[model samples]
Target: MDSQHPPSPDSEQQTTSRKRRGIGRIGWAVLGTVFFGSLLLIGILPRLSQRSELQAAVKEASTIPSVDVITPRRAAATTNLELPGSVVPLNQTTIYARSTGYLRRWYADIGDRVRAGQLLAEIDSPDTDQQVLQAKAELAQAQANILQSRASLAKSVSDLKQARANLLIARQSWERWQVLVKQGAVPQQDADTKYATYQANLASVEAAQNTVNSDSANVKAAQASAYASQANFQRNTVLQSYKKVTAPFSGIITARNVNTGVLITAGSGNSNTSSSTSNTSLYTIAAYDTLDVNVNVPQSSSGILETGQTAQITVRELPQRVFRGKVVRTSNAIDPNTRTLLTQLEIQNSDGVLRPGMYASVKFAINRTNAPFVIPDSALVVNAGGTQVATITKDQTVHYQKVAVGRDYGTEVEITSGLTGNESLIATPTVDETEGLRVQPIAQTK
Candidate 1:
């Protein structure tokens, strides 16, 4: 109790603090006001101000000058269209073996020129030769049989003659005997015997006639056999010639499939044992002096292509060389699958410079027309609608006129329609320029 009065000052202060709460109401209110004010200014106000400034910039840039300037002028041009096509030979053929035989030798080979009826190769037909010999033997046997039959016929004829003589002598003897009997110089029995002898002689003469007829028939049969044998022998000899092979036509030997000692099977049903063996060709020949190119044209362009049309062919192998040709023929019907017309072009290659199966490009000029307005391709502006050329009117204003374009030259285009020749055409136009825009004209320097 003694210090209580003095401690009163500091103690009284501590007691007073305890009596109050954790924070004052005024301090809480002030903190809440400051947080809400900062959120509004930092987040919402800046977005509003930025949006206004962006809108202002957009409006300002929209009014800026857009395009550069270009002048219009006129130029002369020719219109021609280019078509894609390949070069081809006019004629081609593949050769195959016709007969089966051992390839004896090849006289002609690839790249060798051959004439019509020239021997291409020979076959060793030992089998065919043996068959011929066998046929000849059979023929000789037939001839010998014929000779034997002829000799038998001759003997029969002699016998027939002798029998007729015997009959004549017997008849004379019988008549003499009969006369003697009647004159009482011969006996009756003897005259009867002479009559019997005369009958016997007549029978012998008839028998001899029969033998002669048979012998004549045998002789004819033998002659026929001999003729048949001769014919067979001749056929055999012809078959033996199959060993030699000849070219079917005059052509160069473009292919050789067989070499010496290669066995070639006879083609078709020809028997190797027959007198005539089928001659199998060992080399294939083709006439390459002329070349043909087959082109498939779309149906749309088919109408313009016809026989005798002029064409130019360029070979890929020989790029610098261009061969002149004409449309030799065409398949009048269009192919359904490809919807293309088949056309053929012929070119002469007498020098043999153009080989078969070489790739080539063919160009055909289908239509040619005079263009009223022709200008350089650089002047054209292509958009979604169609092609157009920027033209300058007399009032010095630029306008885009839609135009129908025809053939295209390397640097120029043909205006088929929608343009008058008198209008000034722009050689170059700026993309930023719009229709109806005023432009300053300057003559283009060629």
Candidate 2:
């Protein structure tokens, strides 16, 4: 809009300087834009590439399942087999009266230790005492009868001697008469009377001899009666001795069924001939210097049990104490009903800590020639096919192995077959797991 004018040198120089300054500013702005764009491309491209690589790795890992694996370990050669047992005394019995009577006094009681033949109680048997007195009186009467019979025998002998003298005198008289009659110096009637007198004397002598033999027989009968009376008296005295109850063996009394004045009957209360009766036994004695532990061993382990095998016994009441014992006997024959062997163990109980009728556990250390492999219970895969275990191969492939189970140890199970104890086993296989399944095996710590 202004009028055209001729340019001056100063104006042209100023214009040129302004144009050069604008061109320099444009070039610097273009260089700044190029440098900032290069920096952004360098930072964003690396982030995108790393994100894509991470996504690919995650996708690949999701296809395979991670499995926890464990190496199989061999079980111990000698394992402790624990079983239930019942404790009892080595010798136990119930004492009863041998004679029927009333209890008079007691010397021993429950928990009293006594020696053999020690008196436990006394019985008052008036009947036995009276019988003994009667037997003695009868024995005395028999002895007196024997003495009287002997006196009678002596009198009979004296009579026999007198009769023999008379017989001799009569024989002489008869001979004199016979000689007189033959010589005609005496009458025949006088000879006949002399012969009759001789006959009478001979009859008296014969009667005296018979009386002497009867006296001798009476004396023998009296002596035999006296011997029988003596035997009866001795038997009564022996019965009286039985009135005193005594211990048959050295033991501790466990029960007292009778007190003073209680009527007791003869015979044993524990005899198989009768059922159990109350107040029948005077006392129950048990020998506890040694204790017996009875246990029924299972059939699987019974074959290895024998006498003299060491055992360890523990009771719940005595938790801290471990009683050591040995097998004393075995039934040898198995019980078909229970499929167990009755085994008895004897333990020294000098301290008297172990008692009868206690529940206890017995442990036996059984050594095996071939120990089976053991695995966690979770490793076993039980199904319709059979018992199996999930194992991993070198290429991380799952293989189900059939295994024969031996003993069940609660948390673990014994593999009697199908394992060499060198395979890697899956600790906890899932239901989805199958044979020849590819998995990522991860070793477990335990």
Candidate 3:
């Protein structure tokens, strides 16, 4: 009641002044609170916004995968081309019998060294020997017949002379008899008788001349028969010489198919004359002084190929050794079916260490004109657009880089044309990776 009592004019004025001062203090406090709150909001709002932006940036960075990046390297000035080939000899031939006979003895066996004209085997050909003797006898008989015919020809010439003499005498007598008959120097019956005698002499001369002509024809027929017999004798003699089988050329005997007692036919190994191979080859000889390799060079490497070019040859059997050789000859034509060039390379195997028919690998040294950049094989990618590689930009975005590739090394490839050496390429890009995809590029270690 005392706190709520009505005030006198002086006291009431004092109370009102006190209440106004209190309200003023309360208003000042409210103003200070509002000002401080405004300052705090102005200071903290920008920091909160900055914190949100940093968090968003961190999230964006985590979304991208870190990838290894590589740069291209220069290729070598020279390149090696490897291909498969087979070994062969300079000359090889299968021996055959020139005359049908039974093999008597073989001086040369498999792996035996022989010289040209050396006896390789002997044949027992009793039939050929008897045939030769018969041919000689026939030749001698023909020669005797020719001599007898020549004597007849001599007689024919003598007869021809006699006939001519008789003809002259008969013609003169015929003229004489006609003259005497016309002159009536003798009796008519006597002159007629002389004319008849002259006519008979003329007929005798004609008969002798016909006999000479027949003898000449006989001589010619005998000479022709003698010539034919001589030819047969010469052929038989040549056949007899073939009983001793001699090496046509110096070489090593690679095979001996005929035993000492096997029967071999004539022309059995002549590729053109004989198709019957039922008789095995008497001998197989090969000249291995120089080893030859036959290889099919790819068509793509034809432009750089040349005769007499050097090459390197190796075989699995001779792993530690290498054979140096040169290009001997080429078919000069690309095989359309295989798309390769048939080439022959020769190597001097004087030591005889290399044998024919060995499987070999050949290497050809090639000079590269425009050596391309070498890149990791894993960097290449293929898609609908063709072969390309994934490259990273400055902003960590992947870009598709089209590239032309050449020869392939096992883990690397040659880039013929495309990027400079400065591009950062993804070493291993997944199939899902594509152009414009974000990535984190990390430098690759060697």
Task: Candidate 1: count the clashes.
Answer: 9
- Global lDDT of each model? 0.72, 0.90, 0.85
Look at candidate 1 and tell me the lDDT of residue 367.
52
- TM-score of each prediction: 0.49, 0.63, 0.71
Best by TM-score: 3
Candidate 1 local lDDT, 242-334, one digit each (tens) = 667777666677766666666666542222322334334345567767778778887756876778988878876787888887888888999
Q: lDDT per residue, candidate 2, 131-246, as tens digits?
A: 99999999999999999999999999999999999999999999999999999999999999999999999999999999999999999999999999999999999888889989
Candidate 2 versus the native: TM-score? 0.63
Better of 1 and 2 by TM-score: 2
Better of 2 and 3 by TM-score: 3
* Local accuracy of candidate 3 as per-residue lDDT tens digits, 1-446: 35776667999899999999999999999999999999999999999999999999989879888889998888888999899999999999988788887778879888998999999988888888998999899889988988888888788778778777876776777678778878987667766776677677677677777877888788888888889889999898899999999998888999877766666688763222123344546788999888799999888678788888999999999899999989989999999999999999999888888899999999999888877899989999988888898999888899999998887888999898888888999999997677798888889999
Global CA lDDT computed for model 2: 0.90
